[model samples]
Target: MHPFSRSQEAKEMFQAQSHLYNHTFNFISSMSLKCAVQLRIPDVIYDHKRPMTLIDLASKLRIHPSKATCLYRLMRVLVHSGIFAETVVPRDGKQEEEIKAYVLTPSSCLLLNDKATGLSPFVATMLDPALVSPWHFLGDWLGGNNHEDCRDKLNNPFEAVHGVNIWDYGRKNPEFGNTFNTAMAGDCQLMNLVIKDYKEIFEGLNSLVDVGGGTGTMARIISEVCPGLKCTLLDLPHVVAGLPESESENVKFVGGDMFESIPSADAILLKVCTLGIALL
Candidate 1:
């Protein structure tokens, strides 16, 4: 091959290799974000009420002295991933000397534990070992290597890995079940911001049914924005059992499977019918 052609081919190969490496290690970014949430990094920064120096952050975290540098390295990854922001500021207002400080970005702001829109629970739950372990069996499940009877009955990688469906697994494990419920509620909180703007959609509608509406977070939001629209929240009997009554006259809770029979309404809302929850 010509010399220039050979060099160009090598360059292309190197670019391809870099792409492969990045895609292979993408999980590290997620794991790093999970670590930040586990450490309450966002909450710490948020509560500090100002840009926090690295040393101050470490001190607040109460991590051992030896791990301070490791914490910085972890922060570096999060900063690069846009989960946090780092900037240089004057040390104690002295112009000549500067120190690095970390601050919450919009993304990290969503992870604050105290905020109504906080998604820290969602982050923790999604990255939980029980939820993540199924990915390891994805190839096997797709290759038809799972037990024949199990494969015949199971629907997805999660069921194949855990030997049970997600709902059953949640029922069997109370701690994880609470975490999953909190995560779902946290995730649904974002709807509060946008539901009001779409109030017209509920106009002229007398009633609506929210299928799989866990704990009625979405129902309450809709009812508040569209006061005339009566909202019925439906889920498994166990999921809706013993729930406190809503203050809103427009919202009511009913427990039943979506597949069996959904309450008759002007419209049906199925917000969480995605592949992860529904297909599994």
Candidate 2:
């Protein structure tokens, strides 16, 4: 083999290994980000207008001075992943001794809990151990026997580990349920912001049904914006049971299953629905 050809092969191998290395260490990125959130690293940066030096950040985190180096290592990884940024700030107006200061990036800004529209809850919920532990079952779920357990009629991973379908789980556990509900509401809030861009769809519809519309938040907001359009909120009995009484005469709530039947309406708003029911 020519010398250059061997070098080219080695370069290709190096490129392949870099991709594999990224895939392997990706979990560390998630774990480190979770640690930063638990430690309130983003909040610390937000509170400190200027960049925070490693020593000061450690102090604010209540970590011993001895563990400062380890925190620096974690910050280095976060900075590489674009979660945080680091700058070399002068220690005491001397270039000889430069201190590393951390700043939150756009990605990390979403982790702040102080902001009203902050996605900290959604991030925490997504990273929760309960939600994550199920991934380990992927192989088991694939290789193991498929049991016909119908206690909750889960029929899938989200339902199996959660002990109920995603919607049912939200309904059954209101506190954790509300977290899921608010996440949906947050999405609707974003959609509502640009709703005017798609007003034509709703313009001619005399009535609409929102399937799996928990607590009627989306329907209520829509009805308020378009009082002339009658909106029906279709969800499980438990989900709609305690929704506040509607002031808009056009808006109505119904507790029922979407698989067997969806209440008749000119248009239907099917917010995430399970394949199990959708196939039926």
Candidate 3:
């Protein structure tokens, strides 16, 4: 049958159906991007230092020759999604058929694993099997909890799926806990730049404490900016387990619960938005 064989009304119906299908499977785009990151495609393109042809990239990645076409297909989607850019690159010996090459986009640059501004850890954290598995249960939860409807299933979906709270689950899984901490640290590193943007926030402050500061990444940044200020980092025991207590320059890592009793400080830096100053 030729394309669009039916009446205009049927064609319109088919178009709407196609649109519904497109959105219904939109998670594929997100998964593909995550796969690209896991494969280190962004960093590979950056390491190449120039636009890299698909064949060259595949070869560098050590992918099977038979899968070269599939690699091309994946990159095609990524390029369309703006994770990578395509440009016609001329082969050294052949001028007739130019090979398409890929270059990293500004967005991919932030995903670099080696960069200070890297959000790769964040991506890894979000795309972890544990986190993604929760979504698969969302529909089931809405439908019913084995016997009863979702309304009867009072358990938190994540806890229900994993059998533990996110924090407890992380503490149980060292690898995941480290990744979560690193992801938070990466976010803090990115947010720490705002301190320079707003220097007045720290002005006249003699001391500070970063409540729930993971790995003291943010506290160290603030301490570096104001060396005279004594910075104490307070976090759960598991979180600050391996963090050096010898003072990471101006920041001190204290392993204790934040709810019990926080170390006193002139000013308390809580995340980015909130700040507290103690009375003299």
Candidate 4:
């Protein structure tokens, strides 16, 4: 073999190895983001009202002195991922010295607890063990090793891991059920932006049904945007049970299964249903 060809092959092999290593460790980024959200780092930074130094942030988080260095490392990863921004600012007493401070980036702004576009609940719920555990069994489920009967109704990883579907699991675990509901509502906050850009879609429609709408967050947004349009929110009986009535005359809630029947309406809105059982 030519010497140049051998060198070129070695370079390509090293590149492939680097690519593989990156993909294998990509979950660290997601887990780190989850950790940040769990600690309410975004909210803490926003409450600070300015770029916050590492020491001040550690103090605000009530982290121990021993863990301050670990906090810095975590923040470094978040800053690299663009979840937070780092800036150099003048030290309090040292005119010639500067310190690195953290600020909220556009992505982290959505994680703020009090913001209109807040999705902290969604982040927490999605990263919860109940949801993430399914991924561990995904390979087994796909390979038909998780179940004795491949033709069984349990066709998804969540069902294979938990021995029941997500809906049933939610019913069995009330706390997780509430968390999931809150997360769904929080996730729907993005619809506010969508409605603003596409308000014309609802103009001709007199009535619309939001199938499997959890707690009517999306329905309320639509109703407010299109006051003339009537919006009906339909979901499982247990999901809509004991919910307070909507203040808007144009919005109403109904308890029913989407598989059996859906309320009649001029338009049907189905958003985020594909991951309704698992990821969403």
How well is each residue in 46-145 modelled by candidate 2, as lDDT tens digits?
A: 8999899988888888998788889989999999999999888889779789887999899888777766556666556566665576666555555556
What TM-score does prediction 2 earn? 0.76
Predicted structure 1: lDDT: 0.87
lDDT of 3: 0.80
Candidate 4 matches the true fold with a TM-score of 0.93
Tell me the deviation in Å of residue 208 in model 3. 3.2
How much lDDT does each candidate structure score? 0.87, 0.76, 0.80, 0.87
**Residue-by-residue lDDT tens digits, candidate 3, 33-107:** 888878999899999998999888999999999999889889988888898899987886588878789998998
Ranking by TM-score: 1, 4, 3, 2
Q: So what's the TM-score on candidate 1?
A: 0.94
Candidate 4: give its CA RMSD in angstroms: 2.1
Q: Write the per-residue lDDT of candidate 1 for residues 151-220, one digit (tens) a residue.
A: 6467888887788878788889989888877787888889887887777878889999999888888999
Q: Tell me how candidate 2 scores on lDDT.
A: 0.76
Would you list the clashing residue pairs of candidate 2?
A: none
lDDT of 1 at 56: 92
